[model samples]
Target: MRYNKLDLNLLVALDALLTECNISRAGERVHLSQPAMSNALSRLRNYFGDDLLVPVGRHMERTPRAEVLREAVRDVLVRIETSVATQPEFDSRDTDRTFKLFVSDYSMEVLIPHVLAIADAMGSRAKLHLRPQSSNPARDLERGEADLLLIPGEWCSAEHPSRVLFDDELVCVVWSGSRHAQQGISIDSYATAGHVAMQPIEINEPAFEQWIQAGVGAPRDVRAAATSFAVLPFLVVGSELIATMHARLARLVEPALPIKRMAVPFPLPPIHQAMQWHKYRNLDPGLVWLRDLMIAAAQRM
Candidate 1:
């Protein structure tokens, strides 16, 4: 199909129809009346040379072709919305918008307090939903389910727009009264000790794997593993367990827990916390404001 021949407005109508499955609801979704939505659907059917959406009992079901076209259509719609919508300066004091943000538990520990404080200063009209980071954060952003994700630099995708909010080196954290606490950890001592670690999904990041593999020869025992980085500090307290984590987390957890930061026995890659969003959000005023706020919070951390 030629790109110039495609009708963008019909794509919007089709997307709404696909999602809502009812002509009235689809029209409401696009702020069109019933007749306008019906006309749009007829035009879309003619354009696509298929019913696109067929009435299935009480709801609409997609044709086989529409199923294959859904994702591409949605992508085009999102880009168009981003381009056409007037970028409004977000006024947290005036608008009560609830933003769903994808954040790791570690990010909550390090970034939430500052974010909340900022929200308070901005009159507390914005509500935040902290969600777990998805394996495909870019998809979430494209679908408009998650406004922003607090993620590591390694997860950055070339197609998305991202900015490093802050950077830190990794530190080994151990119980203050544990054997490794009083003395500096040596390669031999570090390898032999029981360790609690956060397991990274095998995305084939060489730097991270090299660091983990380096300590495998000594006492490198993976006694416990957790996906949540925030749990590592708590798990190390009063136990023989030791954890390697971002240095910023050590400072945040030290005063609260019976933990001390030990020098890493081997070198590890620096960790960068990045705020990631789809490029489509670049022109969205609300997204821009939220992204800036997230950057400021990360800097403060």
Candidate 2:
């Protein structure tokens, strides 16, 4: 279909359906009465030549076509909203909007206290919603399920606007007075030690394949493989298992736990944490303000 032939209003209705995933809820999101929403859905169906949403058991399920269009529709609406709407001035001192952020548990352990301190000092009324980082970041942003994503720079996509929050080096953490903390950690020693393993960002098994291929070894001695980075230090502190995590997080967790950072026996790269937002939000005033606040919080940390 030609761009000129498409009705922009239909895009808004489509965005609502995609966000709410229910006709009634979608109607409410767009401020259309139930009957009007049904009519709009009908019109959308005719225009798209497909049932955008189909009843599946008790809930509405998106059609393949609808799923494919979801991101595009969301992007378009976000662009329009940013383009036409006046940006609201965000006063952290009095605003009540809740900001949803996706971050690794490890990040929260280190970053939350500092962020809260900033909020406290600013006397902001906004609340922060922190969710664990999932494998699907693009989906979260498009659905409005996540307002912002916190991730390592290696995982960030240029499709989204990003700002580097800080750089962190790797450290091997073990119990403060544990034998491992006082002993040498040669490559073989590390390879043979029991450890708890985790990655701050989601990684596939194949990515680790390259390391194993490069004469580098795997954590063959891992007692447990956890999906959350935040749990690594705790697991290390409570057990004999050693965990390799970011230096910043290690520092944040050290005071509260019986863990110590030891020099890595082998070479590793430093990790960088960054805040990412969809480009569609580039011009939205409220989002801009919130982004600045997040950056400021990171700086203070």
Candidate 3:
């Protein structure tokens, strides 16, 4: 369908292209072939008389015109999705909506299982696409790429609506046979012990434990770093390395692993896991339903 000689369908491709800045990836995002995406890019270039994307050092970069259109295009698509595409009333059992969520491995282990159980009991046909935490989850929510973001309260964006789902505290974990376990961990020992850290992929910022330790002028002797919090315990097993992680996650893994959880020797703040969604999608019925399910799951926890 053309409006003023512009094919409205191209806006979908344009959004993908501008967001991804790569033709093949954009095509894959929209389920279009690479050749078809190339054709769409050519047509978009012709219509706007500008190269929306250009090659730069083996990577695609958006042109100035494309940069300007990025937010505008995203906003248009979000409005259409939330306001026009959604139904007035949500019936989870009948709809085939796919809810995309950004979550950490911790949340996936502690909370997501309950959600799936509840959804299954309700006979909901909706699909869930669980994505790993991204470097810019707020941007993904703003662009309507993520239906929800489950993260610590401190990381949530103020521009969106958020609610705390559950609370967890940080605990120190050490091998059952480690010297620290036998003697009990002290502040000095915790500060000087060889530590295994969980660093978020694609994120350059310090982890929560690191930030807290920095505030107290304490430094960890990090011996190894893993991307997933679930791996921290495994890394600590049969080793002298200590790991600081969420208490809930530690409890879940402690029964099977020969690891012991100890109280943090320092006063660290509790983890308030939160759920955030786009401000404009506050009224989306399907999202509302999914959020309710998640909240219920958290309540059960």
Best-fitting candidate, measured by lDDT? 3
Using alpha carbons, what is the TM-score of model 2? 0.81
Q: Write the per-residue lDDT of candidate 2 for residues 59-79, one digit (tens) a residue.
A: 998999998999888776666
- lDDT (10s digit) by residue, model 3, range 84-181: 88789989999978999999889999999999999999999999999998888899999988999998888899899999999998998999999988
User: Candidate 2 at residue 59, lDDT?
Assistant: 94
Best-to-worst lDDT order: 3, 1, 2
**lDDT by residue for model 1 over 4-91, one digit each (tens)?**
6877657778888877778999999989999999999888788779998887887778899888777787887777667765346777
Question: What are the clashing pairs of model 3?
Answer: none
C-alpha RMSD by candidate, in order:
5.3, 3.8, 2.3
TM-score of each: 0.76, 0.81, 0.91
* Candidate 3 Cα misplacement greater than 4 A, ranges: 1-7, 24-43, 57-59
Q: What is the lDDT of residue 257 in candidate 2?
A: 88
